[model samples]
Target: MKNVIITGTSRGIGLELVKCFAEAGHQVLALSRNSQPVSDLNLKQVTALSFNLAEATDFETVKAYVNTHWKQVDLLIHNAGALVNKPFSELTPADFQNVYTTNVFGVAELTRVLLPNMVKGSHMVTISSMGGIQGSMKFPGLAAYSSSKGAVITLSELLAEEYKDSGIAFNVLALGAVQTEMLEEAFPGYEAPTTAAGMASYIFNFSLTGSTFYNGKVLQVSSSTP
Candidate 1:
């Protein structure tokens, strides 16, 4: 069983990933700004940590926690992200900074601190949006979010190339529109058939095996695809 750490677990995909990993018999370290309602009274190996993930300081706390207890992480999914949907004209520097702090910088910082203890067979899963690759026409408010995720796509590709022989793998799940709290919050009119829990299951099952076919690869799952 692997030890998995996930941030932004209060709702949506992050919460789903947390439960999926726990069910798969892996030790799950869930960190978020809020609690997940304590669905299971019999909390086994699953742990929930709360933090403002965008803050740069969280990385050391996360790394220190693992170093003290588990000593290593088999998988680190940077699934916690924020969407700033606003017209570019109205987008302020603060808006971009806040989004980047959580979406890119925070994730990168956490990975850097954790990599020293992360071993072979370990994988990193980052959830990027199709907007990261293709700009969204229906939602112009997503400029900040789109640009931030775009950086993630580029970062993963470079990291994969750099660590090609390190026994470490990096991949991005460039998602289409999925039904989640964030989705509705960002785009209220979007119709989604797949929920966060379902997507979480897909991510967990997909990462179980080691496959370079999808490694260094950007896979997009969208509701608009045929």
Candidate 2:
């Protein structure tokens, strides 16, 4: 079984991903601000931990735990993100910073801390949004969220190239609207074609086998445009 690490596992896509990996017999380290939902699962394969990605130092706890418990990580999914849906006119600098802190900076810090623990042939997946993909449809209120996710896509590309010799594959999945609390909050009354469980299954399968054939690619996964 693989040693998998996932962030933002309190609910929505992250929570479903934890279930998918844990049920498949992989040892999963699931992190979130509130890990009670994951802990409630009580699955031996899953270790739920509380973490606040906005605080870079919070990753120290994860680093210590991984150093003590796991020799290597087979997969790491950066699934945590923040959405500040507001018109550009109403958005503040702090709003942009907060979104970037959680979506980009936090991922970079966590990945940096965990890099030593990742074995050769390990896979890294960063969950982005279609809103971030260049030339894709754009919405006015998603400026902060979209820009931060866009940054993540570029960061993943750079990391993939830098780590190519290390045999660690990195990829970005620019997801379309998935039925989740975050999506609901971002676009009120809008219907999403994909469910959290469905997206989680796709992500889990990709994490297991994607590194074999794909690296440094940004894939758009969606059935219907939001």
lDDT of each: 0.79, 0.92
TM-score of 1: 0.92
Instruction: List the candidates' TM-scores in order.
Output: 0.92, 0.98
Among all candidates shown, the one with the greatest lDDT: 2
Candidate 1 residue lDDT tens string, 142-192: 888988988999998988899888888888888877888778878787778
What digit string (tens of lDDT, one per residue) describes model 2 on residues 84-175? Answer: 88889999999988899899999999989999998789999999999999999998899999999999999999999999999999999999
Single out the weakest 10-residue window by summed lDDT for candidate 1. 35-44
Q: Candidate 1, 202: how far from true, in Å?
A: 0.6
Model 2 scores worst on lDDT over the 10 consecutive residues at 53-62
* Global Cα lDDT for candidate 2: 0.92
Residue 190 CA displacement from its true place in model 2, Å:
1.1
Model 2 lDDT at residue 52: 94
